[model samples]
Target: MPSQNEPAEPLAKGIIPTAKQQFHDLFVWKQRVVITNEYGETRTEWVTPEPLQNPISLFMQLSLKGWLYFLVGLAAWTADAFDFHALSIQTYKLADHFDTTKTNISTAITLTLLLRSVGAAIFGLLGDRFGRKWPMIANMLVLGLLQIATIYCATFSQFLAVRSLFGLFMGGVYGNAIAMALENCPVAARGLMSGILQQGYALGYVLAACANLGVGGETETWKTVFWIAAGISIGVGLVRVLFPESKQFRQKADVDESVHTVSAKMFLEEARLMLTREWKMSVYCIILMTWFNYYSHTSQDSYTTFMLTQKQMPNDAASRASILMKTGACVGGTIIGYLSQWVGRRRAIVVSALMSGFLIPAWILPRSERALSATGFFMQFFVQGAWGIVPIHLNELSPPAFRSVFPGVTYQLGNMISSPSAQIVNAVAESHFVTRGGERVEAYGPTMAVATAIIALGIMVTAALGPERRGSRFELARRAGDRVEVGKDVEDVVMDAEKPATVQREKMDEIEKK
Candidate 1:
């Protein structure tokens, strides 16, 4: 097989394909070359259009240890999601409890989102440098405590302050959770696992909606949901204490001990090197994630409000619809995530976006409970269906040495940029009014529909035009007797030592030269 860095074979007579042809190739299914190394690690390179393995058998390939890692990651992520949506789904109740408008209460959401990037940067580096375990443990435990703090805030200002602190810790979860989850998964099963893992967010939403529905629509009942979220977060943190560090992380540490003295200076230098080389890809991922954050937040955050104001539904009914909407999100994320393995990540995302865009009219035009619930379900199915591909897609694009930091930072930065999505939706919807049954009402349905439509188009264009690294390798351990020098050609060193060249070395070389 050819080196992964080699240029693609020419189409004919050494002629390179045009941009249109390259775009067309994004949708074409290709045969893959599966290569296994001396360490028993395997990677797949797309070659030509041909059938591959059955999806079911691909899922069956994961080891028992891989599943354990994936499940713990999933639990942490789910707890994080529940904590966030607990507030978002109860916007009205919170507004009423604090004696403020819904738009003002949304400021708390904004503050939480705005500061998440800081947490991602701090904890992500810690995970990359020290280990994934302790930083994550601290993040989860603190988030639980903050959730409790939210329950005690007697004033709106205090509420916003607590949520801002919440965002800091919440930002840390995605990077560490995903790195632990997918890094150990078999390459063939990654797409499926990625789909399942990303839905922890949607599942969190579902759980929050259920809690809201159970507690009724009283103004003070939002605190009950917060209490539940607190328990889940703290419980997941304690459970994490029972597990060992990620197998890949442990192996890499062991190898580093023999090859070179692992030091903070060495780790920082490597991190700086990765940033220098991957700045372009980093910018692109941030842009992609920004659109995605908007895509999910715009469509889902204000949905219950839309049903309450425009469609004239009761709180219990709106809560039920919200539950159904997120349930669709969970299902869509998993199935499309599985299909991405065969159809390719970009293709799956683009197709899902297009489908969701078409469904916007049906999503917002319905008035009856049954109609709204059905439309909401299918709409989120495609909305979050596209989201299902993100976790693994970001991981695949990340530099090998900084998987935790790279995906975490980019994703949270996107959250930072799109922090005002809900505020924007609320502001626009409240300012504008539509005549309903001879009375004026907030125009939430139109605002959300238009925003979702535009975001879906943005997602399609960005995903189609962007790059992919579907089967990149993650193993970082080296053979005994290999030595690594800081700021040297690490790839060449490993090659000279008679070991297979790693993806990390290739990335390190590119960064070092720059």
Candidate 2:
């Protein structure tokens, strides 16, 4: 592979057919390079980086890449468990598998919940280190097996261990998937991309709920869902084998690693540099927004079915409510989320997060079950809408080389903050709020709303303080006006063009295949 340490020089991959010149739009606006040809001039007139001759061409470049990775991200995030409703109905049977008290079996679920953060950070690092393509593939296979392994465990300890391990693999699926989505999309498309990416979590619940309803939890084949999980993971893994490595990762790996001696000290130094006093504020904003996102999915979503049952709704009805919540989430994440791009991500986050404050308080309404479900749908659509920006917003804040670390850490940190809250809240609700014949309302519902509102405040704060990267990064920091900032070894860490490299250089072929 050739060393491309130069800022303005071009290198061609099959997608990026020619090396893009070191052109900097120093004007700090949203437009591509366009040079017009004049007919009557004796000397050809030269115009500096004006807007593109055709902007849609750039759109195509941006869209095609973003869309491809988004599809992959969807598959990676599609395994969320919504069978908590079913589990409640079939608690006795599930307890039998653990060979312990039902409470103990119930407690083991914490293992699965906590470990996913661990997986996200671990696999996220691998995505940055080796490449996004292979770790993702391997993670799928492992996660599938772990899901299947969930079925045959003879002891609660065994089940907990397997779930924790499964979470580790699933973590990779998400953290890397987010990194992949950012590398592929244009800056303009990021908010939408993040919104779309967040929808995958809701979609996973839909899949799990449908399966739970179909299986009905009574058959020996309730374990069949794991089979489905396994099959999909394996299938997706195969497809990802042919998936393109980001031109960015390949470029860096071909030359030298962006990071040397991946130690805590070096990591801190790099983090300090990235999170300058100004960037520190941005990091906090990322943390706050991420806090809501992490809690909403893990704590709130996980407990909805439990809450429905507690409220005296039938199992089927409760399951339907959870499904509807996710349905609302999918729609909200995809369509209404456009506000982030228009209002600016900061205002969009504040407005959307504040909606959680209103909707969550509604859960306390004295109302019919149907009315409660409607409010659930409303809360998910808007409160969760704020979360959709996280995927894109966080990525934009991170420089390329530290991409995997920051996203992974934020995601896990959010999970860590929220998961225990889910448990503690569950315990508190059980102790104090028992109603309807002393059967506590599902622990996830009311507590989740409260949890999310507090976290939403954090998100709002982050948005106010974080760096805004609305246009080309090169121009935003004036890095292009002077020189690219990466060290010779670090330059390749994030040099992706919105298109594939087409020159088909034999360089890095084996590295790519491996």
Candidate 3:
């Protein structure tokens, strides 16, 4: 150790936010793959591990049903959001009622997403501070009510105002639902499970598209879609009331009162402290990766709308495109879950994000509507579809202190970064791209392609340096200076079959490697 007066040497242990006074105490029951003793020898625990026991046992106990439940909740939440996009059509209806331009409808969805992102910050903090269930319940209830209320709007402004309000709750169910799944499930399964859960958003989008087709193209038809969403939200909310709090969050509560919890104020302060040079190295790496993955997701929103209009497609066609995108997104989620099992969620996420940046744009630029729609489906399926794995990856890596905040905040930060993306893309697609005639011939396709490349580059960067919490025992991770680690949703159980047969002792956090 260096003398007090000597400038401190960079320690092997990275990202210390004020040498945690009793940091080891925090890992009392968390899972682990391999642990270090005071003598510095690696020890592996073999006791029958269960949820809240050690990371290994916690890892083992995550059943398929648990993952399925998370998926159901996630599906309901995302589907609600997907359906809200149909409001873009309804937005025009409200405009037309007052004899306004139909184009205003397209803008409404953008405003809604912006509002939803802001709300996620508030509710995400709420999920961390309070329990995850109530916030989820509140989101579903509020979203349902808003869906019903959307039909009653008579003015374009009224429609805009209502939809914007609706957006506030758009991602509400998503954040809490993720927390619930992460907190309740085992560490190994967190990545794939979270991905499965998140696919609900994509599913909702597909379902909404089908509903739009059935409802047909009328001002009244769009109103009916909102009613359908409202009913679904209410039904899901009611079901949520019966779900229990996450077992993971509960573990933190059983600790000594003095070491029990960090206040919300302290939470924010911790996040600030987390920004120090040491932490920034790792966090920034993840942020960059996230920017790429989410860039694809957000740009897809713009691409779907742009392509349909570019095709001069009817409302029903547009609706079908939305459904196809959602289905593709679901495929993306499923693919993430399946592939992350082998490639690892972090690697898979980075790969998918980077590749989606390439493929998602392909969905838009095709010469024919059939080609465009097919590309959109595969883009979401292969590139963006793998998006579902992130929740699992993020949950496994993050410590309890930050779990509630990181994923949603990280996702939203990407959204914020991508905010100017549309305008930049619009400039490039329309005015920036030159043609012999100097006329706009639907710049949507190329814009999406460019956006895809940027997102892909982001994924590439992340793969190079992002943390790997996949299948690594959490307790051993902490002692290994892995505190800042943020794991993934695609359950990395590659080691499940490799577990060691013996153990001598357990540490503050029980970790064992096969």
Candidate 4:
């Protein structure tokens, strides 16, 4: 194995091969043949653990600029999530308001998830070709407009149309926000920051919960929630406008100009190269994301209904249990994310998934509200702990030139594939309904537990077999080269850009030689 401080292997004159080349070099086909003795069973282990570091020291070293970039991404993602969930949580209200069936209203949600990949492709390509700034600005601005439009929508068709457009704009935000955030982050802080950044989704849900509560969770006041969401998103966009362009993007633009002016044609060429060269990685990522999305939706979506109907818990108790679960998700994601830096990203995720498997019995079989809440807390701790690694993991594996699009596209595609998760779980659980207290109750607990256990195992296996580019450089030049010299910081590119003409020339020569 290469040293942690060393660039990934297969670099020559600082140029790394395409994804296809890397896959070819790394691919292995191994038989499970092993000798089993009374003493022990032996098999090959694939883990390559990273070095350990102090938790405090890890966070203390981040520069202010790094924090800003990370916060912006987190905030935008949080707001995006908030808006989406506010609508989802008010599904019953919306159905009543529009005088449609809940199933009909759900079609709008499906449209959003279904068309997000289209949005990701458009915005992600634009962000890469132009810069991460204005594309994101437009995405956020459009999301706010859509939210306002949704509030005024008179007919069910108008509501669906506006929301479909919202999904398009919402899809664009993830790539640009993540690109702007992690592109400028220091490699050392990425794991911890990523964990925190990803929790924005959960945080958004929590905020939506608050909004629902603030407005009495009534069908008539759901429009007010949309208004609040719009204000927040638009406010985020205006603030984003004030932030300067990320230094890494500027450096990439400079390199593109030096080679040939960056254009849509160049973006298309990069896309072609990425899809053709990294198709395997791309497919693998989408599969992992599909399992992940299903895991999340199946575990949480029907859980409250399960608590109310199956477990006979009161509405307040079920709500409390949900809150407890989300809190655990937030805390667990952060801790595991930070720990991944020392333990390795893949290892952390696999461990979290495996640990989650052990908690299922406790999570689902509890009879009392208190026991249920406690179990739910620990259960989500592992489920979302595994999830916390996803954003950074995807970003790290993505091609440097197409990092923005690759992660977003893969993520949205996975979301699209798993869009029917809630429906599937609900249907399956209904079929397994049990007669308890002379009433037919949906078997949500057993169904969820079994499904989650399978997902956890799949996650473990997928993560174990997948690649890791821990400490990978994010800048365009180093990514093109696929090498970062040991002990050298990519942030130095910013300083290089500010150097005198002669010094800059010498640096360029040095880079060319390396």
Candidate 5:
């Protein structure tokens, strides 16, 4: 098999096609080029640079159904983020409510992280085997109920138990959402859409911050945030019910059912093949995700306390900074995600990581509240900007048969590995102190700054060596659909052209077998 970077096989006149060319014809992205030899003999060549769609017009080309599909995934993911962060943003109040240390409350967070992989494995297999629709709905409904349950927890153990179960259900949402959202998306539109989709996480964080601000950050009011998160999650489930299974999934199902029964055995075979083929890529993705989780948690999680305690800033000031940073994350994620379409995935991630590293000083060293807020904005901007590419990047790299399970499992495993980040930072920072306004507090600035810089460098290096599958087809049928859609003047013309040919081919194959 040709490597991802290798060009497509060169065509020759009156020559039978090579095996590589035959494979390329079915899958990889291709472009036409004109070449002239030294003897002035002109020939046409096909090259593959993972062509990009017209950025401005790309989204406009998505049908109404496509937009709806994308929105459902986004809403589900956003709700997932909202429910998770609802607890995170209110950790202080919860610590007080349970009469426990912050570290104990963090144990709940860790429990949630640890159990997410269990959810991913179970729900991911269900999603791949059955369909993405109902599993996703189930995941969200359970998550909402758990959020409500969280509101009624009278003890820390009860709270931790609810959160642990919540983590399991929460893990189910990500794989299914991205699978539902981007599976039918045009390859060209994926980068831009991926950026927007990943920001749903940051957007959820922003919503949680707003909810906290609205509720005045008191222990009693924290329950209200959970209530809101529950509502959002239920609403997500209801909205998803409006759509059918994704087009790519439906197509894949049609193909699978024709060949063999869809069963656990099929899933197992596919998983085995995928792991054997792309285990290295899977390992690399998990590592990248580990660094990413650490990057986000370390930079944001403890920084609020750092502001309120070490910098002697007001709670309002700290909240304002958090909101500003998340807003930057949303905007940056979208922009960098779109840029990745042209700049290439690994390059975009590396550049963003390096840039974020350079801003660490300004991000953490600022004494003034205003300056810190501004630096925090730009800091997360670059940090999450790089993160924006992840959804599509992972999807593009995933094996077609195992798309739902592969990305989710790796991401959750990474979350599990990075679960200790906040505690680690806290333990390290306890020994350092800073004095401001006659109050001496545990210093977090240096620790966060140094940790972020190191993580950023690690991300840059990891991404630089990772593969790029920018314009890979989402499913086999997509190739025919894309070809017809690309040059057509009318949107309806594509289905009309491809459907009969597909039917005829199926008919001929069946007749031949008979």
Candidate 6:
């Protein structure tokens, strides 16, 4: 340890931020600057940000290839969301078809959530070790087959079994999708792209609700939504076959070839080293994801049932309200995600969480279709607005070599921990009663309100205390002796070389003197 009179050494990479530092970072906008040493090696340092760039200009910075990668990743994620929400939104129909209680039907959801961690572990490692393309293609194709299998289930047990299998495949999509989507994105464009990308979930929900609306309220019509979901998943998989592996992955492979052949032993050694270094970050991310999973599932899964039972809305009205709700989510996620670039990620998340928490009373109190639709829209806007920052936030924090596994495993493990959220809500709502118009009803409104409030508070606190690495470089590769270099590809190094050299000599001189 340094003497009290001397300044302390800088914290190692991935060290947790102090509360004071976290608070400062919440409001600070650091500019990413490159510093080249005498030996012609470069590393990034964060200082005061320069003048803000136009959002349009930031978007224009992406090459055509970058846009294609982002779009394909978004499509895969949207299809995955559509497949999962198809079941959640149609829970009542499935229960009636199976001649089972709503809680029992929700068991399928619980099983699906519980098993997703396994898929994440398997596929995330596959994505990190192999190329992202084949693992994602396999995940999407298998998910489509599972969706069709779900439609053919003759028994509730079979339905549960199929959904469990579905969960396993579903867990793999998020890691690869976001990794491929944002890995090549310019630092300035990341927040905007991340926002747009995360909204694929809301868009999927909207599409599923629209399908449910079109097919009408008949018990058997849920099959049509499942079919549509299956088509979308299969279509995305087929489309992915046309694209080459992500440029970053290809570059990494080339660099690895020079150092040593890419093999299982090398991959495992890297993974073990990463875990030893980053276990704390991994644990923190998992906790954050657990709160987020609970926040979304508890507020959303049984909302249609809540409207039908407690608010006395018809199926069509409830479906419309749900569609409007997710539409708000799509809009909010995009807008807030964009604003996070300027306002800072954690501040954006904390503010959105608090705002959504405040809106809970209005969210649950509305009875009429128009009233409920309006409130639901605003509620989801803030709820998912906070969520909009998640994709890029996780990507920024991830270790460069294991981006796929780190985010995916943390997210799915969180999903595993919070798997029973919907079931818990259902059981509690059914067991407890609330009075509406002098009649008793399942207490979904109160249940959701209380749960959402607690979750919102949790998000605010967790995010406020967490560390951020908002513009860390991703175009990295390992050199000899496992030293990671900032630019791997020839083109990238050339680009950096062309930029003006304004090295922060004072900082370097100070470090040398110490």
lDDT for every model?
0.83, 0.55, 0.56, 0.73, 0.76, 0.83
Candidate 2 vs candidate 6: which has greater TM-score?
Answer: 6
Model 3 misplacement above 4 A: 1-35, 38-72, 88-107, 249-286, 289-294, 297-299, 357-362, 420-441, 472-505, 508-514
Candidate 6, superposed: residue stretches over 4 Å from native = 1-17, 27-46, 50-52, 251-260, 477-514
User: What's each prediction's TM-score?
Assistant: 0.89, 0.71, 0.71, 0.81, 0.83, 0.88
Off by over 4 Å in 5: 1-54, 251-260, 477-514
Higher-TM-score candidate of 1 and 4: 1
Q: Please, what are the lDDT tens digits per residue for candidate 3 over residues 1-514?
A: 2222222222124434312311331222222244333454544332222322333453457676575556556755665665565554344344555576434454565566567667777787777666677777888888888777777776668877987888777756556667666555655565555666767766666666687789876766666777787788888888877756654344343334342333455445545544442255436534753565355544555554464445556777766776776677776786577556555555566567656656654665565667767877777775554567666666555543345555566655555445445445544555544232454465666666666776667665554444434553332211101122123111112122112212222322232221
lDDT digits (tens) for residues 340-426 of candidate 5 = 887677777888999999999999888777898799889988988998999999887776556788789988998899888877777
Which lDDT tens digits does candidate 1 get at residues 226-269?
A: 99999999999998898888864464553335435456765666
Give the C-alpha miss distance for residue 238 in model 5, angstroms. Answer: 1.5
Candidate achieving higher lDDT, 3 or 5: 5
- Order by lDDT, highest first: 6, 1, 5, 4, 3, 2
lDDT score of residue 187 within candidate 6 = 78
lDDT by residue (tens digit), candidate 6, 1-514: 2122222223334435465556555665563344555556655555664445777898898899999989999999999999999999999999999999999999999999999999998998988877689999999999999999999999998999999999999999999999989887887888888999999999999999999999999999999999999999999999999979987456544333443344576567667767776788898899999999999998889898899999988899999999999999999999999888777778899999999999999999988999999999999999899989999999877776677878899999999999999999999999998898999999999999999999999999899888776666654432112322333432232233222233323322332344
lDDT of 4: 0.73
Better of 3 and 6 by TM-score: 6
| Model 2 TM | 0.71
Flag the better candidate by TM-score, 5 or 6: 6
- For 1-514, candidate 4 gives per-residue lDDT tens digits of 3222322333222113333432342332211111222223223223334565676676677778777877888899999988888776666578789997655676777788778888998888877666778888888888988999998999988998988888888888888887777777667777887888888887877777667666764569888989999998998899889878777455544333443333455346546766776788898899888888877877876676678668887555666777788788889998898888767777788889999999999999888888988988888888889888888888877876677888888888887887776666666776788766788888988888899899889887777766666655554332222223433443454334223333445655566555
Per-residue lDDT of model 2, residues 414-462, tens digit only: 6555555434555555554535665545444566556666766766654
Model 5 poorest ten-residue lDDT run? 477-486
